[model samples]
Target: MTPAARLSAAIEILADLSARRRPAADALKDWGLSHRFAGSGDRAAIAGILYDTLRRRASAAHVMGSEEPRALVLGMLALMRGLSVDAIAALADGGRFAPAPLSEAERARLADSSLEGAAPFVRGDYPQWLHASLRHVFGDSVVEEGAALAARAPLDLRINTLKGEPEAVKAELSHLHPEPCRFSPLALRIKLDSEGKAPPVSAEPAFLRGEVEVQDEGSQLAAILARPVPGGQVLDLCAGAGGKTLEFAALMDNKGQIYAHDSDIRRLKPMHERLARAGVRNVQVRSPRGAEDVLHDLEGKMDLVLVDAPCTGTGTWRRNPDAKWRVRPGALAQRTAEQAKILEQAAHYVRPGGRLAYVTCSLLDEENGAQVRALLNKREDFSPVSPTENVLALGASGPALAEAALTSREGLLMSPRRTGTDGFFVSVMKRAG
Candidate 1:
């Protein structure tokens, strides 16, 4: 596909996103199905352009003085990707299957437009409503944090230490072995070149043998922050597909038990196969059975409860850029409320002196710091614990690194900027006796 054709595809997808309430991915998939002539390169290029435009839509609109897809594509090219107007015009010039030529007005607009005072647009491309919340969480470094959110992310894989160690997996895939991830012991960070394509890990022998799982370094770190102890009873509430549950079992050396429960039984069904493939034996998949089925016997008996609660997933905008465009304040508030309920329910399963870790892949404070604060405020029997200390105490890492990574207080909040991993908030709480 020509560059202009990619822009056209993005425009069509953006229209679908704006008209209906569908995700960009779904729309792009539908487009791909209808336009079967597009090859893999064409599909990827179009998808990349669409996502990049979504990531900076607000800012692009500000510069172009229009929110139309064509204007957005042009603005994004000029401002975000630094494509010159002449270059874009050349791409849109008389060519087969190319987009319509750039209008005279568009050329003038591109030349004269400046985004000097558009603080929200230039800083992070976020809506104005999010400024206060973002500032509340990031303080003075909100701009840098927003910039990170706008950028692309690399593919990260977590070595399934249950079947094989990281070193063994690396040795097996020696040719394709990625750089060691700084934030996660199990992660291998695969950096893509300017072409923006990650190598196919599924085709790798290590992946086929269940030696590694393609998970973000941030996600691997979030699971690690839970600090599962060997032979300790653990509960992964909201364990969708059991990706982290597999990690939990590995952490436990397949000893003791991990009760993996989710409201949706259909979601946990696939995990049975995944666990088998990974040689995970310690997990017992439990369907909610209308909340009481899994809740009755597990009350106040767990040593560790991991609440990988649902949220807006703002931290993952780099990978799922279209998500930023779909997020609304009301939806975020609803998610926050649900996260609180999940936390409260999961907290009930943690016995006195047991630990409960609340986690989310969101950059929002309401889902992270604020949720922990609310839980602490509402529950008399729960108190904040040091996450770094808990992990170190579990023998997760050496004392020197633990001391460097953790605060004098216990809660561990990892920013993508700080950790070079996913934006994750992990708050460890102790159920007071």
Candidate 2:
């Protein structure tokens, strides 16, 4: 498909998403199924345009003076993709299967568009209602921080040390050209194309042979900071899909007992194959019989309990822009409630003097620092663990990493602006013996 046709496809998909309140991925897949003539490149291009529009939706609307799908696409092209006005006009020209040429009003607005004087939320490309929450979390740097979260993320893969070292995996997958991640020893990143697509690693020999798995660098850091000792008793209290569960396995060098449990069995269903693929033998999957019935035998016996709690996923906007728009205030309330329950429950399993690490892919304070504060307030036995110390204890360059990240009350919040990765918060609390 020509660039013009791809832009038209993106506008249509965005309209469909708005009308149905559907996810970007779902809309894109449906479009692909219906437009079978579109090749992989065409689909990729359309998806890139759509996600770019979503990522910069608010700012685009501000620039274009319109929030319609076409306006958003045009704004994205002009600003997000850095397309010149003439270039965008040629693509939006009234050619066959192309969107109508840019309207005079759109052209006028684009010609004079400026985000410098716009509202902070508009400049940040996030929803206006989230301004207060974002500011409360980021203080005066909210726009800078949110803009980074609005940008596209590179593809990151974690080498499965349970199977092989990073060098062996890097050598095995030389064709894809993976680079070592800046902050994680086990991570490799594949740079995204201009259209934000990475070389497909699913078919690579290393992945097929249990040497690597796709993971965000920030997530890799979170799992790394959990500080589970090798040969120690570890409970992955919310081990959905076992991404970090597998990481814990590698961290322990496959010598420790890692019990992976989740309240929802559906999420745990995929772990069996993934664990087997990563050659992680130390993990035992505990599928809950009820909402929170798993891990009965492990109470008061765990050396480390990892709670990768659920949240509104505001931190992952770079990857799931639609979610940031779709999320509601009520959803945040629901998540905080769930987090409180899970933290209290998971605390029971931490042995005396053992540590319970709380993790969330959320930048919201209510879901992160506030939750830790509540835990500390309720139970005087648990105290905040120094996130800087955790980073330092994990490696030789702990000071550098701690410097690169934000030190929260009891943890660290890693963001794309600071860490060149997705937003992740991790807090480790030690129990009194």
Candidate 3:
């Protein structure tokens, strides 16, 4: 497929996305199926255009002076990809599946605009409603933060201790070099100079060996905040895909029982094979069980309960750019309710004085700070603890964790802008005896 055709495909997908509420991935898949003649590179190019357009829809549209898919694609090509008008014109010839020549208006907009400095549209690619929340969380580095969110994220892998230590995995996958991330010891950063390719994640031998599992650095920290000790009764109440559960079991040296339960067993199905392949034996999958029944037997018995609650996933925009487009202000109320319910349900399993770690991959206050506050207000038996402080008290090698942990008066909120990880919120609440 020619560059013009890929642009045309992106425009079609974007138009479909704007007209209806189809998921970007689904829309891309459907488009791919219909255009089977397009090669893998063509599909990836089209998908890239679609996600880039979505990430900066408002800014790209504003800069390009139109919301049309053609204009947006042209704008993305010029502004985001740094492609010149001549380049775009050259690639987008009127070929099969290719879009027609750019209209005079489209070419004019692409030629006239500039994204040189920090503009409002560039500052916050998210919806207007999210501006204040983003500001509150990101404060001074909003531009850098927003840029990170707007950019495509690289694939991250967590060396599965259940399979091998980080050093061992690093040795085995030395071809990838798998640099040790400054934040999470378990995390290995995949550095890419340019965004041409996603750096062969699934094809890597380390992935096939199950030595490393794909996970964000922020998610790894959240699991670490839970501080799963060896031989502890850990309950992952919202164990979707068992990533954290598997991580927790590794922390426990696979000695203690990890009751990995979720309301949706369908999501947990894939974990069965992943767990076996990773050689995780300590985790016991509890599926198709009602939340009430699961908690009834484990009440006040679990040493740690992790609530990796559901949220708007604003922090994960780099990976799932479409989520920003899908989030609505009204949906947040429903999400808040669900988060509260999950917290209350999971809190029951926390042993007396044990920690209930609440986590979310979100930068929103409603999901992070406010959720911790709400839980503290409603539950008298639980008092919130600072995970940053706990980690600091233990002492780390890089820097004093306590300095940041002690300074922040509110709950723990880790932003990708600051930590080079996904946006994550983690707070420890200890049950009062």
**Model number with the top TM-score:** 2
Our model 2 lands, by Cα RMSD against the true structure, at 1.2
Tens digit of lDDT per residue, candidate 2, span 213-280?
99999898888899888999999988999999999998899988999988888999889999889998
Candidate 1 C-alpha error for residue 363, in Å:
1.6
- TM-score per model over all chains: 0.92, 0.98, 0.92
lDDT string for model 1 (237-316, tens) is 98999888988888789999999988878888889888887999899888767636656788999999999888898888
lDDT of 1: 0.79
Best by the lDDT measure: 2
Per-residue error (Å), model 2, residue 354: 0.6
| Runs off by more than 4 Å, candidate 3 | 95-97, 115-122, 290-292, 393-410
Q: Give me the runs in candidate 2 sitting further than 4 Å from their true place.
A: none
List model 3 lDDT by residue over 89-194, tens digit each. 7767776777787667777877866666646546567777787778776677676678778877766788887777777788877776568776677888877545
Worst 10 residues of 1 by lDDT: 401-410
Better of 1 and 3 by lDDT: 1
